[model samples]
Target: MQRIALLFLILGLNCIAAGAAEHSTACGSMQLAYYELGTLYYRHADGSYTGIDKDVVEEVAKRSGCKFDTVLESRVRIWTQLKNNTLDMSVSGIPTPEREKFAEFIPYFSTRNYILLHRDMPVHGLSMAGFLNDANLKVAVIKSFKHGPKFDEWLEKLWAQKRVYEASDIDSLLRLFLARRVDAIIALPTVWQPLLKKEEINKQVHLFDWAPQDSIVHGLIVSKERVSKARRDLLRKAIYSMADDGTLEQIFTRHMGSKLAQELRYDGPRF
Candidate 1:
């Protein structure tokens, strides 16, 4: 009986070792893309990156014991590369049908769409219909962003009437809005709040939530073509752990504040 028990213990230890090796081999190294979107990601003068997204990514890497080769890219290009499997991972991703076919999203935060208008713009009841009826109110949007279904519907209507301006990236969109080239821009409170820093600029901006009932979940995106099911499961577990342990809330609070952080804290079913 003693001999038999020893044999079982040795086998169990070997199985654990094998499992650890497999995990390491599966996610030992990966490619990650980052983009500038409000307080999510930004570059520093010393050629380093920081912000909520960066902090989250680093924490994930630490937990998973995976080394990430980070690259800077536009949101549009990030999606394209994710579809092509040329990228392994990216932050602040909201899944779509086409993207679901090529990537798996592990949600970490939640946000809703808001329309930031200049205070001097014509008062229009703060409704989509009011804004849509006013042909003079032109809005700018980032190229490949998903600002929720309602915003997309309004944007489509606006585009049909040539009342929309498209920007290549967030910085350009902010410039267009600040330069008075556009009447308003679609953004999340967490996104626009940090970008519009000047007190005078803040005074000129008025934010209205167009989709108060809708909350969009955003998080780490892993490419299906490049990542195996084993790795995806591992990553999902790591992200879920972060969400459960207050790590995610800590990161959000550090960058955006306790109130906004609590608002963004994701407490939904894991996908």
Candidate 2:
């Protein structure tokens, strides 16, 4: 496994010129749409993009001998564009059957744990069902996102009862929690901690380790229609190589922290 995951040469024009190749990844100089999902992807005032996702893409672009121009959009719009074959790729996408119908996921390199944060700590042993049972309580979650298998099931139950409040993104989720619109909101410490400080909401709420373990995984979600099978395969191999070389780990740990980087190690396949 270690040998297979080792850093491979980033493909360059010289490498291609050295030997004649047939199919191109179509990744050469393409436009990409990104979602403003915290540290994963950030947009700048000049309309340029930068962050962990950017780093990964740049690395891949360097290897693939491709250049990617990026634009920011809402998650829903990102999916819509992908379905319409207007977008190229995205980062930190948690795979689900519905998404796979339109896009293909590369080898996931990061693991994320979802926990419930509340205005105050609830009773010990409180479960997701406990929250669902109380009609008065509302849980805030990102729209069109799958929070692992267990929470996905629980969220379906909550949705059926109209007990869940869906938001467009994490910023909106934080707003919903701040306004006392939802009793609890699902969050990732790496994503929300900085927001809590910047927005000055740390003292206003408390976090709960509701997730049993850290298993949720994510990766670069590329559109199948826009990216060929060869390109996607190329990206998958590159991502796995990044993990093996600790480049992926360093990039994530630098922005998110070492503890989270360790917790969210590249654990092979996501089931």
Candidate 3:
């Protein structure tokens, strides 16, 4: 009878394992949107995606026992599709009240934005207000990117003065900046480090932290319409678990160095 009981217990554990596997499979594959943002997510020569964001998503899927299908899209389009319920998930998203209505955000990382300028530009020590007042100096920015309220306000004023260039995406923005089409552009370290690795590009560009107090938390955003509440919570919990386990920091550290990784993980005054 004891042997029989042991056999029954073994069978019960096996059944539990099978049930968990089935549940994981039942979760289905989610559509994850990625964009070309520095070391966050980008395509490679082999036509594959790899970066800090990609690693985070992959690890979350592993912990949650879910699958994800990632596709490339611009930051603007990613938000639009999330609102339309056409996209299931995305990483590196900043949460706002409007976005929170259509999606649930899981905060994982923090970073600040800066004004990248040509090394030769005479805008050193100039505040954002001063930069704005210089009518001859034109600026470019990635469309639909939020660089804190002050930077956004400066952009608005620049726009009103017809001194702003709106690039559809990061690559185009970098090109415009590099080609000297725009006098300055706003970028985060994660978005510029990988793209500006070339010696010449590095020499041509410099950054001004217009708003030192402006830090923003970014993370996974799940569509409330397409993803069930339970599933969304599951993903969020997985990400939080990753943060607790130091997986998120390690991923960022692997892509960027330790200094920037620490800042991205716990910068002061997060927006």
After superposition on all C-alphas, the RMSD of every candidate to the true structure, in Å, is 3.0, 7.4, 2.5
Tens-digit lDDT track of model 1 for 175-245 = 99989999899888667778667686788888887888778889789998898887778788888999889
Q: Measured by TM-score, how close is model 1 to the native structure?
A: 0.88
By lDDT, who's the top model here?
A: 1
Best by TM-score: 3
Clashing pairs in 2: none
lDDT string, candidate 3, 9-39, tens digits: 9999999999898878867899998887789
User: What's the lDDT for all of these models?
Assistant: 0.85, 0.72, 0.83
Model 2: lDDT to the true structure: 0.72
TM value for model 3: 0.90
Stretches off by above 4 angstroms in model 3 are 123-125, 266-271
Estimated TM-score for each candidate: 0.88, 0.82, 0.90
> Taking the candidates one at a time, how many backbone clashes does each contain?
0, 0, 0
Model 2, residue 204: what's the lDDT? 72
The total of clashing pairs for model 2 equals: 0
Q: Give the poorly placed runs of model 2, Cα more than 4 Å off.
A: 1-27, 43-49, 121-126
Q: List, residue by residue over 70-159, the lDDT tens digit for candidate 2.
A: 777888988788888888887778778888999888754655446545646465415666776677777889888777667777778888
